[model samples]
Target: MTNSTRCGECILPDSLPGVNLDKDGTCNYCRDFARKEDRNPHLSADERLRRLERLVAPYRKRGREYDCLVPVSGGKDSMLVLYAACRLLHLRVLAYNFDNGFQSARARENIQAAVKTLGVDLITYKPNEKLLDQLFKLFLTRTGEFCTPCNLIIQAAAYRIASQNGIPLILSGGSSRVFGGIQGVSQSKYADRAYFKNVLQGHVDFREAKRFVVENPWKRAVRRYTRTGPNLVDVLDYVYPGLEQTRDLLEKELGWRPTSDELEHGDCVLNPLKDYLQNRKWGYSEVTQSYSSLVRTKQMTREEALDHAEEEETRQPPAVLESFLNRIGMSREEFEQTKHRHFTEFPNYPQSRWYRMGKKAVALMRKVV
Candidate 1:
C-alpha cells in the first residue's frame, strides 16, 4: 500500500497489495517463492477444487453436459483450463476456439490433442482468412490496434454458440488484472453481454465493424450461411479460474506436457508480436502489464514475471518480421515511416482513438525491425 515499497527484484510499484518491501526497496513479490494473499482472499487450490465441484454439480447432474464453455487456442493456458474443467470439476466441457487466422500448426495439433484425450466436445469458428487478412490490414494500417471489432469477433463467435445451446456459463483463463493492473479493474466477465455492450458503445458500432467485415470475405460467407436470426453474440460472466487450480488439472487429468519453449512464457504464437508491440510503444511487455497486477495481488512474484520478460525479446524471429512486412506490402523502412507519418499527420479526436492505439501497436512493430 505504501508507494515507497518497491519489489526487491523487479520494477513493480509499491501501490500493489501483498508487495513486501525489504531494506533494498525490493518487495517480497520480486523474490523467489511468491505467495498469494492480499486485500481479497481467494480460495486455495484445494478449496477452489471444492468450489468448482459445487459449481459444476448441477450441470453434471444433467448428464453428458458441458458445465462450462471454454474459449481455447490450444495454448498452455487453454490446455490447462480445459483439463481443469473436465477432470477437476468432473463436468463435461465444450471447448470453443475462434481461429483468427494466425494459429500455428503446433497450436492446432495441441488443441486437437486436448479435445481428443479429454473426451470434451470441440467447437471451432474460423473467420475467413481473406476477411481476416483484410481486417488485419485495416487494423494494422488504419486503426493500428486490433480494436473493438477484432475482440468482438473472437468473443462473438464463441458466445453465439453459447447462446444457441443455452449454455449458462463460459469459462475463461485469468482476470483483467492480467492486463492493466489491479487499480484498473475495468474488465468484467468476458461472457457478460451487457458489459460487452457497454464497452463496445465506448468505441464504435458493431454495425461499423460488421460493415468492414461484410465488405470483406466474411460477409460473403455470412451471406451463404443465411442471415436471419437474433443476435446471439454477447459477453457473459462465467467463472474465472485461477492459475494454481488451472495447473493442477492440467498436470493431473489432461496429462498435459509443456513444450520446451513454453516452460518460460506464453504458449501462443501471437505473443511474440504482442510482446514486441507492447515493449516498443508502452515500454512494457504483456507480462509486465500482466504480472504487475499479479504481484500486487500476490498471485505471482516479480522474479517469476521478469523471468518471462527475459524471453519476450528473443521470441520474435527475423523471418516473422520479414513476412509481416511483406504481407502488408511495406518494407521495414516504409513501415517505420508510415507509422511516424500517421502519428504526426493524423487528426486527433475521440473517434481517432483506434488510430492512437494502432500507433502504439505500430511502434512495437517498428522497434522489432
Candidate 2:
C-alpha cells in the first residue's frame, strides 16, 4: 500500500486515526493549537512560578516527610521536574523509579546523579521479573504491543507509594500539551486491567492472570475517597520552558549528558521494537508525534523535525529486537505472525452500559472541578 499524505507544515502524516487535513494542508492539531494561541496569551516563566508557588504553598511541610513524589526515569523531562521541585519551588521531594528490567545503563546513572545531586530521597520499585516476562510474551503474541503492563504498573505504584507514605501529591513529568495528540489507538479502551484480563482469559492460567494484572479497585477507591490520597499533577502544565531551553538548562545546571536516542522515550531497550511495530501498523511512531509537537511550538523548524523523524522512522536496532524477543520467549515465527496481526483484532475493554455511565460521571466531575 502507498503511504498516506503528510501535513504541509509538520511531519504529522495523514495515517493517524481521526486526523483530518484542512484545505490549507494543515492538520487539525496544528490548527487547534494555533487557534488557542490566538485566543489566549502564553504564560511567562515568572507567571508560571507564581502560580506554582501558590498551589504548593499550603502543602509545604504539611506532612512529616517529603511534600511530593516525583517519578523519574532519568530522562531530561523528569530531571527538569526534579530540579524545579527541589531548586526552584524549594519543596522536599522524593524521587521514585520503577525499574522494569529494560532500563539502559545511562538512564540508571542519570537517575542516581539527579537524586544525589539534589539531595532528595530515592526509591526504586522492581516488579516480579518472571511474571513480567510472561505478561510481555502474552501481550506481544496477543495484542501486538507489550507496554500496557509497564505503564499501568508505573502509575499504580506511584499512587500506592504516595498513599502509603502519607504524601498527598504525586508530581509526574507527563504533559498533554507537550506530549499529547499522538496516540493511534484509544488508550483508555485497552490500557486497563479489565481489558487485560479480557484478553488473557483463556491463554493463561487464572492464578497467573491475577498476578500479572495489577489493578486494585479498593486502592483506587481509597485514593478517591480519602483526604490523604495522592493527587497527581503534571509539572509541565505550570512551568513549560520550550524543549530547547529545558535541554540547555539540564546540561548547564544538572550536568546531564544528552543521548543519541530521543530522551522522551526514556532508556527502554524495547522501544525500538515497539516503534518499529507502530510504524508497520500506523505508518508513524512516537518520534513523529514528539517532533510534530516541537514544530507546532516553534521550538524546532519543520525541516529539522522532518529530518529527525525520518531517521527514527527508518532505523531499526537488530540486536535490541533479537534480545527482546529472546527475553520474552517469543520465537521468530511467532514474532512475524504477531507483527502482521491487525491491531483491532486484539481484545479490548467492552463499551458496556456501565462503562458509558462511568465516562459520563468522569466528565461531570471534570466540569465541576
Candidate 3:
C-alpha cells in the first residue's frame, strides 16, 4: 500500500478499482473537476438568485399548494434550500425525508427542528422495513456496497411525490461543490430502473419496484425542460454562499445545529462503514476523492486535505458495521466472503446516451444562466 501510485493533485490512487491516472500522476477524476471548475461560466450571486426566481416562478403561481418541494436530509445544504424557498424567495415549501433505517438520530432531530421552525410541512417515508433490509443484504453480498438502494429511493421519491401531489417543482439540495461524485467505483452512477430490475431478476422479485426505483430520469429531464412537468432543480447551484457562509446562515438564521454525533455523509451512519470497507479493499475510499475535491475548490488546501484524509481513512471502523450486519441478518464470516466482490462484475443495464448528453447540456446551461 505504501508503494501505491497516487494522483499528484488529489489523494486518489491508481490502485482504486477503475481510476486511470495520467502521465503527470493526476487521475481522470481530477481532470474532469479542473475542466468544470475552470471553464464553467456561472452567474453573479444576485443574478444567480434571480435565475433561481425565474426557474421557480412558474411553480410559485397563485393558489399553488407548494411553491416547490425541498427534499430535506436534515443536512446544511437542504436546510439552506428550505430557508431560501421560504424566506428568500417567499415561496411555499414542502419537505420530504426518507428513513432507510440508517438515518442518524442527530439527522432526525435536525429534520424535526427544521420543518417545525420553518413552519413547513414534512412527509417522512420509511419503506417496508423487512423488504428494505433484504435489499440491503442483497446489495452488500452481491456488490460489496449498499447505498444504491437508498440513494435511488431518495432521488426518485421527490419525483414520485411531486407527480402525485400536482406539485410543480422539486428543489434538490445537491451541491456539486459539496457532495459531488468521485466516479470509478462500482455502481458509481445511480442504477437506472433497467439496471435495478436486472439486478433483482434472479435474486428477488421486482414487485415492490415502485418503493425503490425511479424510472428513466432522462425522460423526466425532457419533461422538465419542455416546461410540461415538475422541475427537479439543484437549487443550491443558484443560491449557495460557499460552505462556511452557508453553515453560518444555517446556524444563525434557521437555528440549524451541527450534531456532536461524529457523523459524516450528511450524518448518515452507513457512509462510515463504506469508507472503512473501501480503505480495507483499495487502501483508500471516496473520502479521499471527496476531500480532494474540496482541495481543488479551495475550500481546503492540499495540506489540510491530506491531513484530514489520513484521519478519516485511518480512524477505527465504527460500530455501525456490526449493527448493520445484525439488522440485515448477516454473519461476520458471510460478510468477509463478500468483500472482494465488486458491483461492476455484475451486468449494468445499458444506459441512454441521451441522458448523458442531456446532463452535460444542463450542467452547461446552469452556469450560463
Candidate 4:
C-alpha cells in the first residue's frame, strides 16, 4: 500500500475509503457521477452570470446596510468571493472570519489586504481560548480529524451574525468540482452544527461556549422548511471562470498569492497535520484527492495529476503537529494512541436526531440542485 492504485479516467485512488475500481479501471465515483451527470445541464458562462444576478437582486433590494456576507479566510477562493461581491456585483459587502488560533500568518495578511483593498467592513471572531483547546483535545480523541468544528462553527457564526444584522445573503466560494472527497463523492465530514451539538451537549456547557456556537434544531428545521432565511450561495457554482484565470484575477485585484504549495490547503497552519493524520487513518492524501478531482473534471491531464501526486506524497509531516499537541495538553504518545481513531469508532456517535436529518437533507439538496 506504499503507492495507491489510481483510476484510469481520474486520479482517484483505490486507497480512499469506499473507493472501488472496476476491471476497466474506472472508479465507482466516476461511474456514479456519469449516471447523474445529465442531472445538471451545462450552463453557458453568460447564462450562469444572468442566474446569479437574478438570485442576488431580491436580497439586494431589502435595503440592508450590507447586501451580502462573505466569509474570507484570506484564501484566494474566499477573496475572490469578496472581490465578486464588491467589484463584480457592485454590492455593499461585509466580510467575516473566525480564528480558531491556528490560522496562518500569511492568511491573516491576505485577509487584511483583501478587506482594505476592497473597502469592505470586516469582523474577526475568536472562540474562548480555554474551551476551544478542550474541544480540540476531545475531537482528536474521538475522531482522527479535528477540522470539522471549525467548518461548522464558522458557518454557524456567519448565520448568527446575518440573522442579527438582517444581512440577506452569505456568498461562499466553494465548488463541488474542486478538491472534492477522496472517494470522489462529496459528503459532510462530521462538520455540521448538529454534529457540533452532538459533540458538546454533555461535555461543554452551552453558556460557556455561547459566543462561538448556536444549536437550535427546531429553528433550523423551520428555516429549512420555510426557506425564509439569508440565502447562502456558493459563488463557484455560478461565477467561476477557471483556476488560473481566478488566480490571476485575485493577483491583479488584491495582491493575493498562494500561501502554500500549488494552492492546496494553504489557508490553515494545521493542514499538514491533517494530511499526516488522515493519510495514516484513511490510507490517502488530501493533495492526491484534490488533484484527482482536477483530473476527474478534465481541468488537468492525468499525467499532470500523477506528477503532482508523486511530488505531494513526498511531503514530510510539519513541525506544527507536535506543537499543536502540546498546546492541547496532549503528549506525543497520547497523540500516537489517539490519532488513528475515527469519529464512528466512538459509542453512539452522531446520535442526535437533527444531525442525522441534516445529513439526509444534504443528499436531497444535491439531487434537486
Candidate 5:
C-alpha cells in the first residue's frame, strides 16, 4: 500500500497488496482486534502471574516438586517463561528444546547460555537430519508448509518428556497479547492443547505422527525405547505471560538478551524457512501480516513491531536463502515463476500448475490468497 495512506499509527495501508482499511484509519485486522477487546478487559500481570502460579502449584506439592515443562529456544519468549518460573515464581522448571536440523550455531549457544544462567536442567531432543531434510523439502515444496509438522513434533516430544518425568503442568510462552493491551481483552493467537491438537490433526495424520517422531534415530533409541514409553502431559495446567510483559521481565530482571538475528517471531532460525515458504506460497510474508496485525490491534506499538519486522527482513542472508532453495531442489526459475504467477493473479489463488504438486500444497497455498 502507499505510504501516504498507510495507517497513521502502523505501517499498514490499503496499498498493502491485499490489505483492506477500516473507517477507524486502521486495517481490517486492527479493527477486528479493537472490536474483540471492546468486549472484554485484558488480564493484568498480577492476574496473569496468579493464573500461572495456580496452574503450577498443584504439581509443586511437597513430595512432587517439578512445576512445569517449558519448551524453550533461548528466544525472548521461552526465556520469559524460564526466568519467570525460576526467578519470579521460584518453581522448578524443565527447559526443553528440539534441535531441528536447520538451527544456527548462535541459537545453539544461546540455548546453552540460557540454561547455565538460569541454572535450570536442560533436556534436548534432536531427530535424524537426513530424514528431517527430506521431510522439510517435501513439506515446503509439496505442502508449502513446514511449521505445522515441525511444531507438532517438538510439542509432542516435550509433553511426552514432561509426562514421563511426572511433571503435571506444561507452561508456554504464549501470553503476549493476553496481557499486553491496555484496554479490556488483549489480542493473542495462542490457545490450549485442544486447539493445538486440532491444528495438528488438520495437517498430519495422528497415526503417522508417531512414525515421524520415531523416524528420528536419537529419539527412538534414547526416548521411545526407554522406560518413559510415550507419556502424554496435560497442557492447560500452567500460566504464561503476554509477549510484552514476558519480554520486559526476561530482559530486565533475568539479563536475557535477544540474539541479533531474531525476527519478530523471535530467535527461531526456522523462521527464515517459514518466511521463505510463506512468501513463496503467497505473495506476502506471514511475519509482515502477523506483526502488522499486532501493530494495528495496538497489542504492540506500530513503530516498534514494524521496525522489528523491517530488521527481520534484512536478516535473511543471501547464502542461507540460496542454500535452502538448493536443499529443497527448487530451481531459481521455478521460484521466480511462482512469484510471478502469484503477483500476476494478485489477490487470487494461482492454481495453474495445480496437478503437478501434491494436495497439501494446493490446500496451504489456497489459504494465503
Candidate 6:
C-alpha cells in the first residue's frame, strides 16, 4: 500500500478520490471552504436559534401526534438534536431508533435516558435479522461495505414512518458538509436500486431479493403523489456550536455520557469492522473524515486531528469484530481475504464519470447562482 499524504491545512488525505492538492499542499476542500466562508460568514448562535424557531414554528403542534421525528442513535450529535428540539425549541419530538441489533449498551442507555428525560415518545424498529444477515453477507462478499443495507433500510424506514404518522419534519444530526471530506474511496461506488438488485441477483433468489432487498414500488409511488413525505432537516447546518460546546451542554443539562469506545461511530458494533476494512482498502476510515471536518471548521488543530486519526484508524475492537463476523456467518479467514480486493473491482452503482461531473456542475451552479 502507498503511504497516504494529507492536506497541509487539514487532515484530508490524498488517498481520497477527487481530492487534489495545490502547490501549497492544501487540498481542494480547504479552498472550497475558504471560498464559501468568503461568500457567507458563519451564523451566530442567536441567528441560528432564530432561524430554527422560524423553521419549526409552522409545524409545531400541527397534528395530534408529534411536531418532528428525530432519528437518534444515542450519539452526542443526535442527543444535541433532541435537546434542541425539546428543550430549546419546545417542539414535540418522537425519537426514532433504527436498530440493526448491533447497538452498544452505552448507546442504548443514552437513547433511553434522552427520551425519558426529555419526555419525548420513543419508537424502535429492527428489520428481520435473518434477511438482514443475508444482505450484510452479500454486501460484504460482493463489495467492501456491509453498512449499505443498514443505510438503505434506515432511510426507507424513516420515510415510511414519517409518511404513515403524518410528520412534516424529520430532523437528523449532521450533513455531508460536516463529514464529507474524510470518507474513503468506497463512497464513489453507487449503491442504488440497480446496484442492490445486481448484487442480490448474483446470490439470493428472486423472491428473497424482492422481499428483503427491494422497496415496495407501489408504496413509494403513493408517497410521492400524496405529499406525505417528511422534509429532512440537518440540525447541524443551523445550530452547530462545535464539538466541545455540544458535549458540555449535553453533560450539564441531560446527564449525557460518552461511550468507552471511540466517539466517532457512536454505539454501533459493526462500525469498527467497517472502518477496519475501509482503512485496509483505502488507507483511511470514518475517523479521518470526522476529524478532518473538525480541522476545516477550526474546532480542532490539524496536529491534534492527525493524532486522533492515527489512533482511531489503526485500532479495532476485538470483541466487536468477532461478534460482527459471527453474526454475518463469516470467518476471520474470509474477512482477511477482503483486504486483497480493491474497491474498483466492485461495480460502480450510482456513480458514473458523467454523474460525478454533473454533481460538480450542480455544486458550482449553486455557489454562483
Q: If scored against the real structure, what TM-score would every candidate get?
A: 0.62, 0.89, 0.88, 0.88, 0.67, 0.86
Q: Model 3, 144-249: lDDT tens per residue?
A: 8877788888878887887788888888876667654554463556456766776677888888666677666676667867877777788878887876787788
Could you give candidate 6's per-residue lDDT for residues 117-183 as a string of tens digits? 8988988999889988988887787766687777667766776676678888888876544565342
Query: Once model 6 is optimally superposed onto the true structure by TM-score, how far is the C-alpha of residue 205 displaced, in angstroms?
Result: 5.1
lDDT for model 6 comes to 0.74
lDDT score for residue 48 of model 2: 82
lDDT of 4 by residue, 163-201 (tens): 777887889977866756642222244355445555667
Q: How many residue pairs clash in each candidate?
A: 12, 0, 0, 0, 11, 3
- Name the runs in model 1 displaced over 4 angstroms: 1-10, 13-38, 57-65, 147-150, 176-252, 259-267, 291-304, 314-318, 328-334, 337-369
Which candidate's TM-score is highest?
A: 2
lDDT by residue for model 1 over 142-198, one digit each (tens)?
433333334557566665676577665666654443343322111111212332233
Error of 3 at 42 (Å): 4.8
For lDDT, candidate 4 versus 6, the one ahead is: 4
> Candidate 4 regions off by >4 Å?
1-3, 182-188, 210-218, 225-228, 346-369
Least well predicted 10-residue stretch by lDDT in candidate 5: 181-190
What is candidate 5's TM-score against the reference? 0.67
Greater TM-score among 1 and 2 belongs to 2
222 Cα displacement, candidate 1 (Å) = 27
Q: Which ten residues in a row have the lowest lDDT in candidate 6?
A: 181-190
RMSD of each: 11.5, 2.8, 3.8, 3.5, 10.2, 3.9
TM-score, structure 2 vs. true: 0.89
Query: What is the lDDT, from 0 to 100, of the residue 136 in candidate 4?
Result: 84
Q: Supply the global lDDT for candidate 4.
A: 0.76
lDDT of 3 at 188: 53
Ranking by TM-score: 2, 4, 3, 6, 5, 1
Candidate 2 lDDT at 74 equals: 77
List candidate 3 stretches off by more than 4 Å: 186-190, 217-228, 260-266, 314-316, 349-369
